[model samples]
Target chain A: MDRTAPLPLALLRGTATVLPRAVISAITAALLRGLLKTHPRLLENLTRLEPAIVHVIASDLPYRFAITVGRAPITLTVVDRIATGADAQVSASVATLVDLLEGRIDSDTLFFRRDLRIAGNTAVVVGLRNVLDREELSIANELEALCGPLGGTARRLARALEVIADSAGARLAAMHRTLHPPGTEAQDLTADVRRCHEEIAALTARLGTLESRRKRQADKIA
Target chain B: MSIRYLELVCPAGTPSALRTAVEAGADTVYCGFRDCTNARNYPGLNFDFDELCAGVTYAHARDCKVLVAINTFPRAGDESPWHRAVDHAAAAGVDAVILADLGVLDYATRCHPNLRRHLSVQASAANAPSIQFYRDHFDVRRVVLPRVLSVEAVAELIAETGIETEVFAFGSVGPMSEGRCYLSSYLTGLSPTSEGACAPASHVAYEEIDGRVLSRLGGVTLNCFARGEPAAYPTPCKGRYVTHGQASYLFEEPVGLNAIEILPQLKGAGVTALKIEGRQRSRAYVAEVVTTFRRALDALERCDEGTPTGQLHGNTEGGKETCGAYQKGWR
Candidate 1:
C-alpha cells in the first residue's frame, strides 16, 4: 500500500478554494446541524450552557468568522469578508485539514512550523478534530481521487446548497455596519484620544447615577 | 502524613522582583516579555530582551529556575512576534516557555525540541484528556490548572495523568475562562485574553455621582459603590449587571480567589507547584506575597502543621478572600 501517496485535489481544495466562502460557511452550518441531529449528549450540553460563541480566525484566509450561538442555531457569520490590510487572516485550506485528519501530516508540527492555527473554543475544537480524524476519511481520499473535480453543474449545485444554508452575506453586512459605524472618529490618533476621554467621562457619570440608585433601593429595602 | 514537596513558584514581573523572589526563597520564578506576548504585559513590569537574559542569569546563580510565559493567543495572520518570542526564550537559556496557543506549542516543539514546554493556565486544560493530548503531542512537562477546579478535582487530575500541575495561589481572580473570554470584545471592542488587558485603562470610566461611585467599562455599568465601599476594577464578567429586570452581580460577586489556606490540601493533591498570579502588580506586593508563600512552604515542608503565619488579608482584593472552588461548591 502506498502510505505516502499524495492527497486528492478535491480533498485539498474542497475546504479552502473549490468551495466558496458562502458554500463553506453553509456547509459548516449544515455539518453542525447534522451533528446536533444525532448527538443528544452534545445538544444537551449546548442547550444547558445556552450556547458557545465561536471566534474562528483562520490564519490562511482573508476573513474572521464570528457567530453568536444563542440566536442562530444554524448560521455562519463571516466577518471582514475581504482581505484588506497586510494583517488579514488566512484560514486553513480543506486539503490541509484533510491531510491533517488523515495523519499524513502532524498538526502540531505543521502548526509549529507556521502551517496551521484554528482559533476559538479550544475544547470544542478538540471535538472537531476527533470527528474529522477518522480512519474512514482516509479511505474516502482514494474515492475522491476517482471523482476528479466537480463539474460546473455540480459546483452550481453545491453553490445552491451554500446559498440555502449560509446567512453569512447578510451577517457580514451587519457586522460592517456595527464595526465601521459612520460619524465615529476613524483611527486618527488625536480624535481617538479625545473620544476615549469623552467615553471615560461618560462612564464615570453613569457609574455615579447607578450608585445613587442602588443606594436608594437598598435604603428602601432595609 | 506522607510528605508532599510542593515547589513555590513565584512571579518576577520585573528584574528586581526576580532577584527579590530568588533571595526570598522561590523555587521557580516566571516572567514575561515587555509586550502583549505575555498575560502580564503591563507597562514597566516585564523584562526587556537584555534584562531577560540578565534575569535568567541572576536566578540561575541563586539555584532558582526562570520560566518565560508567552501565553497570549496569537493574532490572526500575525504570529511572527510570538514565534520570535519562543525562539528568543529558547536562545536565552530559560528553563521553559509557558505557552497556550497550539500553533505556538507546535512551533516551539519543532523549532526548539530541547526547550521545555509548560501549559499556560490560559489553555484551560482542566480535564485529563486535554492534558494528555498536550503531553502526547507537544511533550509538555507541566500544566498550570485554571482556578475553576477544586483541590479534590486537582487531586483526581494529578492521579489520572501523572503530569506535574501548577495551581494559582493568589492574585486577581478572573471569573471566566482565561484566553477564551469574549465579553470585552463584544462590549468594548478590546479583549484581555487577546489584548493582555481587561477593561483596559483605555476604555474604563469612573465617575462620582451624588457622592456615590459608578464604574463602567466600554459603556457597560459594572458596579456602583458608595463612598466607603472599595471599588473593584470594572471587568465585564465580575461587574454588576441588570438581568431579568434585577440589578446585581449576575456572573460573579466583587472578590478575588485566595487559596492561601488550602496550601496543605493542594500539596496533598499531588500538585508539584503553586503559582502566584500577579504580574501587573507592584514590586512591593510581589515581595510580600512571595515571602509569605516561601515561609509557608518551608513550614509545611517541616511538617509544622500548626505554624503561626503572618496575615496578608490587607493585600487581597475586596479586603477578603475565599478558598474559591476548593472548599465550597461555587456553581
Candidate 2:
C-alpha cells in the first residue's frame, strides 16, 4: 500500500511553509477550476437553477471571488474579504472545504450551527449544496495511488526525482492556512469532525474483512 | 393651510388590493409588476403591465394617486428589467416611482427626468447625510424610513434634513438591514433584496412530526409549533438559534409592528405619511388595516381617542405586537 504521501499530508497538517498565501490560494482555486472542467458532467448533473453570481471568500486567504451565472442572472459571492454582490458566500478552512466536498461533513448541521455561511442567494445555495456533496469520494482512489511508502523503498527513490515540485506545493498550502485562521464558524464545525473520522475508520475495517473472506472462498472454488 | 391630510400611502399586492385600498381610504396606492423588480414578489401577488395601467386609471378617477414600487436592487450586468419597470411605471402615468438602488436612482434621474421619485424603505437611509445624499443625487421627494428608528430619532432626523418621512404604521417587522442583508441568502440562496422575497414559499416546506409542525426553510428546521399554536412565517432572522449555549430567538421574535397607538407622536414627529406594510396580504386585510388606521388618523385630527394599544396584536404572526424600534427604549 502506498501510505506515505508525505508532502500533501504534511501540508494539510500545517508543517510545510515556504510559500505565500496569495499564490497558494490562486493555485488552489485554479486546481478546483481545473477539477470542474475535467468533471463538466458532474456540474451538469447538479442543479438547473444556477446562481448568477457565486462568491468564494476563502477564510484562509485575502482574496474573494465573484462568479456570475446566467443572463441578468444569479450571483453568488464568498466573502473572506467581505465585499458585496454575491448570491452565495461561504467562509471556512481548506480542510473543512475538502471535508465538505468529500461528504465527510454535513452542510446542514455544520452551516446551521455556524460552520459555514451562505450569504447572497439563500435558496439557491441550499438547492445547489448536493453538487459538492461527495466530491472527496470521487478523488480518493486516485489520491491513494499517489501515496508512496517511506524510506528504503522504490517510492522513496521515485520521490527524489519529484521532491522539488511536491515539496514546493506542500510548503505553499501550509503557509496559506497559517495566514488566515479559517474563521470562528469553521472552528465550531470541525469540533465534531474527528468523531466522524473514527466512525469511517471502523466502517472501513468491517468492509475489508468482508472482502477478504469473499476472496478466500473464491480461491477454494478455483 | 392645515397640513394636507397626511397622504394615506397604502400597499396593493394584487389588482383587487389596489381598488380595495383606494376605496377604503388610500390617497395613494403603490404596487409593482409581477417580477423581481418589486419587493413583494409573492405568488398570485402584484400586477401585470396592463393591470397596473388600469389600476392607475381607476385610482385617478377617484382623485387618488398611483405609485409603482420597483424597489429591489438590480443585478450587476442585467439592469434592463428594472429600468423597463420604471419606464413602464412612468408610461402608465403613475404619480411616482419608489426606488432603492443607487444605479437605478441614477438611471431614473437621467432617463425619466420628469418622474417623481420616493425613496423605498429598502434604501435604509436613516440619518440626515444619507437622506441628503439621495436627495442631492436623485432628487428623491420622500423617504420611507427603515423600521429600526425611534420616534425621537425620526423627529430629530426630519428637523435636521427637512426631508419628508413615511413611517411604517402597520404590518410585519423586517429585522435585518433592508436590501443589504445576506443572512437569508446564506441559508436559502435566495434573497428579498435581489429575488424580492425572503423565506420564499418555493423553498419552504412544513413537516408534521408527532403532532408538532416543524417549519423548514430549505430543509433546515427553523421552528416547531404545537398543534394549536399559531405558527410564524419562517424568516431566517427570526429563526431560533443557539447563542452562548442558550436556545433562544437570537435575531428577533416573530412579531408584527403596529404603531396605531402612537399616531399623534408620529404626526408630531413630522411624518408626511403612514404606510401600511402588507402588499402580499389579502384585500380584506388591506381594507381592515387601512380602514382602522384611517379612522385612527381621523380621530387624531379631531383630538379623540383611537384604537386601543395592542388591539391589532392578533393580526400578527405570533399574536404579539411591538412598538418596534419606534420606541427605541424597548431595546
lDDT of 2: 0.71
lDDT of 1 by residue, B1-331 (tens): 1123678788886676677678877888999986778886543347678878998888888788999999998899989889999988988899999999999999999999999999999898999999999999999999999878888899999999999999988866665787898887887786666677665644665555775667677777778776566555567777777779887877767566677777888888989888887665444556677888877877887988774445765566555677777776756
Rate residue A137 of model 1 by lDDT. Answer: 35
Question: Backbone collision count in every prediction?
Answer: 14, 31
**Model 1, A1-222: lDDT tens per residue?**
134454444323435545577865665565455445544333433333224454555545555565433333534455664423221122465556556545454332332223444332333433333223212234343333333474334444544555644556678888999998865455477787999999999999999999999999999999
Chain B of model 1: TM-score?
A: 0.94
Which candidate has the highest DockQ of all?
A: 2
Which regions of candidate 1 deviate over 4 angstroms? A1-222, B1-4, B244-246
Model 1 local distance difference test score: 0.68
Please report, as a residue range, the 10-residue window in candidate 2 chain B with the lowest summed lDDT.
Answer: B305-314
Off by over 4 Å in 2: A1-222, B1-4, B243-246, B306-310
